[model samples]
Target: MSTYEIALDSKAREVEWNNAKCDKYDYMISVFCGLSAGIIDAFFVGTPGKGRLGQWTDKTADNMVQKIANMLWTGDKRSSVDGRPKNAPDTLEKAISYLEQSFPVNYDARYGKDLINGNAISGMSPLNHHLLSLAHSPDIIGLLFSIIDQFTGKATFINNGKLIRLVPVKDARNNKVMYMQGTNFESKVFCGVCNWLGHLISDLCGSSSTRKVGKTGRGAGLPIPFYNLFLLMDLGKFDSNSFADIAVKIFEEGYDLRHGAAMAIPVLIEELSIKVIWALKQHCYAKKEWKDCIPSAKHADLRMMLLIGNATLCLVDGIDAAIRTGIKGGNPITFILHLNLVAWARLVMLVFRELKIRYGSIVDQAVGKYLAQIGLNDAYSLKQYYERMNAIDQKLDSVLRDFTFKVEDDYKVFIQSLNYTLNSSLRTPEQGRDVSVAIAKKEGVKSDRIFRSQEELRYWLGEKK
Candidate 1:
């Protein structure tokens, strides 16, 4: 086949080689790994508040907030001896307060009444306003809205199946106009990004005001990453609450970024356990190369195993959530709160990805077979093709070298004879004719042949057709 065809075939083989198949053994092992992780999730990661892992994640988030607060704390309110800010807001609440004062935004509207006029956003309250407001999300959506709010001096909110933008009521206590800092565009972006991050960090746990009030409840906090997307999904109605309302309720029940982090634990456990086992099996049992044993998503076997494993985990989590919620009189909100949304989301993604890969593989196999039937099959392996090309190149190089050496030697001899003839007497007509006859004999032509013109002479001398 042609080089191009060979190259295309080689690439197809490479892809096929990478997409390793999963056997029944692999699937069983993956299920076991998933079951182990699901058991941990059901027992340790029970619900938002009641689960031990959830509490640990909450404490970890608090510590993270405190550390961030300490970093953002620029006030001279510190004890000289211990280096800890003494009575100057060292706790998470105080740190949040410092961040609030340092990076204040105009969009601190809590309720619909907090707007300039009457109620604009229905059901808007301190508890759910953050969920409705895109800026309060601890993800890319939040970053974009935060930057936009900072520049436009307007707040953006989504509520009651609508997106609303409004001029925020100015804080009469602090009349300072919020402006983007820095001299250049890049510096301004930097300042905006820093401001956005600081603001989000401040709101990550809960508002400083709410925490300071000493209310022992899940106060308003930043939503989980990308959880704001659910606000757009206002279709479903579960027990009089729309999907948006359910999302709000979920956030209200402490399924914020901290709890999201907690939910990640069991998902991660299942993912890692499956990957490790797959890699080990590939290397030890399958006798694959170390490099080939990597559990990348490109491998069909690994993807399938991961799909099965995460599916099992989600299944167990669902059952657990159902049981817990059934005991609580089958409350939908309780069921959602108990469910591991992270695992379910992962399983959905895996399903789509696996379907896509399988579809592509089927198409590829059909195309490959058709091409092979048409005699377009690759004849030479990549290595064999390269070796043959190399041999041909070497042979051509040797032939060219020999031809070059002969030309050089012939040129030298012709030049020396020309020089000798120039120094000697001019040849007579008879001598020139005799010389032509001798040249014809040397060139293996008939010496007695007569030539009429230069063209005829060239033809007789075998120099032209």
Candidate 2:
């Protein structure tokens, strides 16, 4: 049997790509020409099914819908992918219980943020839709979304062959995966992807540019943010509409319904419509809490990772807003965070947007170099930025050593790989769109078709020429 149908996945992905030129997405992974956003590296995609294993491998994608409805009937945790082990925690309470057991701390007290605690049971992959699984298990819900997001634009009808490819798990140890750093999926990525990102981050900022062009760097297996976020959106973190809003909106504060990479910016843009600039300034200066959250005399390195913790924390907070709003665009914090997103936080949004537009797509190779240029050209200071980043790198390594003791050997191995990734990715946050475009030509992708019509959605999404 084959199942294929169009269904909303996480809104975050829908929102992000909604404004993307349709030609880029539907045509082939390669046609992008780096005109849009993000690169495609099959190896960097996170674990298949994103913790939600779909059994409809025959392609009819429809098999899982009935199975979704029947989750409580048989309570099977096994994957349809050739006896890969039943991978879900089973039941909403059980999932939450796993989180509790994993973290061994109060969860709900943090206003539903316990899922992100690295040491908690909630760390079952820092996804927000965990609550969506409250009616079932996060694993089940994650699977349902995996089906929709993967098949949506690609599906022709219900129960089609597209279902067979809906979920593609990570190789886990491929060590050559790639991804973006300084974001949430940072620590959770595969080692291969980490190597690419780390190298990109470094080349973008580090002194070596010409020599590394034709050579491949070491592997770390980090997850790809471009694809990872796509999966997150499929699971309902953001929708096509939100993605559109993200493409257009700058950054203020509002009912942040949009998902994708623009969550923090759009909400701040709409909610703080009256005072967008002021609000940006505030969040920029908001105190980062890495020191507060993991306060301990463990090591100078562990405490050091908290250097960029403020920026990462800001992204997390904004993403949280996206999750709570159903990626639709409603919420009071949009009203509250209006007057305070200044300084680095505000700068981060603008810089991030520019980078995405300029060098974010597969066609952009100069992107990283552009970022390095920006860092070097900054009127304020690149020296401090470099120092902080170096310190943060050291700190990250220290913490990795400390936490590996608590998890399984597999997880420990995963963390061990983070050393290079952390060092490579923290190179710089800015890149030139030109540089990104240049480099995109070399790395292979699936196709060369980018839906040019989708560009219209960018205007609606706030992307202007």
Candidate 3:
């Protein structure tokens, strides 16, 4: 295994397990190895009794924030500055410099038979992913969110401020097709992830990086509230069934990654939920802001984390639709994996809460019966839930084993697409500089996918011009 995978394995091992420890390991490994392709595969294969909700499917939107953040660490050109490469984002100017270099400016000259050599950007569709799988294509590449691009010199910026990743693709083709590798192209998941991460101190290596480079806040042309800290509430402390619902509500109110690393919810609350809730109470959360600040208004990053986490809850409202409608043919596999992982995580928390709320006699009665008689009074519901959890957990382990690039091909495809788009060529040889971006935009999106519109593609690539 590579050093990166090993380190991730160790970290995964260290994390405590509630449902299935092994499966959790697989999840983490997949995150580092290939972005969870196995989960997607399994969902499409249709395990057992996987029910549907109604009309919607996984075609809506994919929250690839974690993957984007991870790419930042990989140093895509989107994270580089003019004078400062991603491999080194020391001073505030360096960070700012990197952002300016990536965000695409002139949309007019993009469309043509070939890319402008260096001007190609990727789209955010599965087609780019498909091409990334191609073996002998020079059009493949990878990208990074602004976080990791601290060392690479290419990352994107919003106007003159707000540094983040435009998209971390590895190739010119990916740039042309994938809409910068962003799912919510118009919504700004790129900047949101960057601004969200900015609220904390990630690479504390030294004086150069974002560790402390800026005028307290607002480095480069970055926004004033780009990294401001704000705390909302701790859901774990609440004693009501509405807590989760309330949490979801807060997420809808726009607490997205703009506010904190995570809300100081109880450890149990974090464990029960389906999504990964990064705790900010210890290492970085309490240390910096909450150390001596007031309870409600202390430590800005934590507040922002919570804000984002909370808002994310609301964003996931379409789960019911996805489950009900069933996944589309083009995206069936991926949607299944995403839905399962997300749903399982959410349900786990809800179940745990139910256990706590209906405690005492119910617990004693059920377990006592199970210990005494196999099927007497039958606390069958409890037994069933446990049994199902075990099965799912086991399945998670199996699915996770091959979810990444080394185990699967989709990951490599995505990586390759990324590489194809980020080349420093100001123009293309085979396809003429004008045609380069036209081809790139197409590379990111596949005509087969459900969401992308050809008109929008034309507008972005200047085909409309």
Best by TM-score: 1
TM-scores of the models, in the order given: 0.70, 0.17, 0.23
lDDT of 1 by residue, 306-362 (tens): 999998999898888889888888678889888888899989999987777668878
Rank candidates by lDDT, best first: 1, 3, 2
- The prediction achieving the highest lDDT against the true structure is 1
Each model's lDDT: 0.76, 0.29, 0.32
What C-alpha RMSD separates each model from the true structure?
Answer: 27.7, 31.0, 22.9
lDDT for model 3 comes to 0.32
Per-residue lDDT of model 2, residues 1-465, tens digit only: 223223343343345333433222222221121111111111111112211111111112222222332342245454546332244533322332222222121111111232222222221322221121111111333334323322221111111111121111121233222222232233433332333222222211111221123433211111212212222232222434343223112111111111111223322332233232222322353343332223222222222222223233344444443554454475443322321132134446545654465456644445445756776536435456667779999999989876654444644444544443345454331223223323334334323521124464476578988
lDDT accuracy of residue 368 in candidate 1: 66
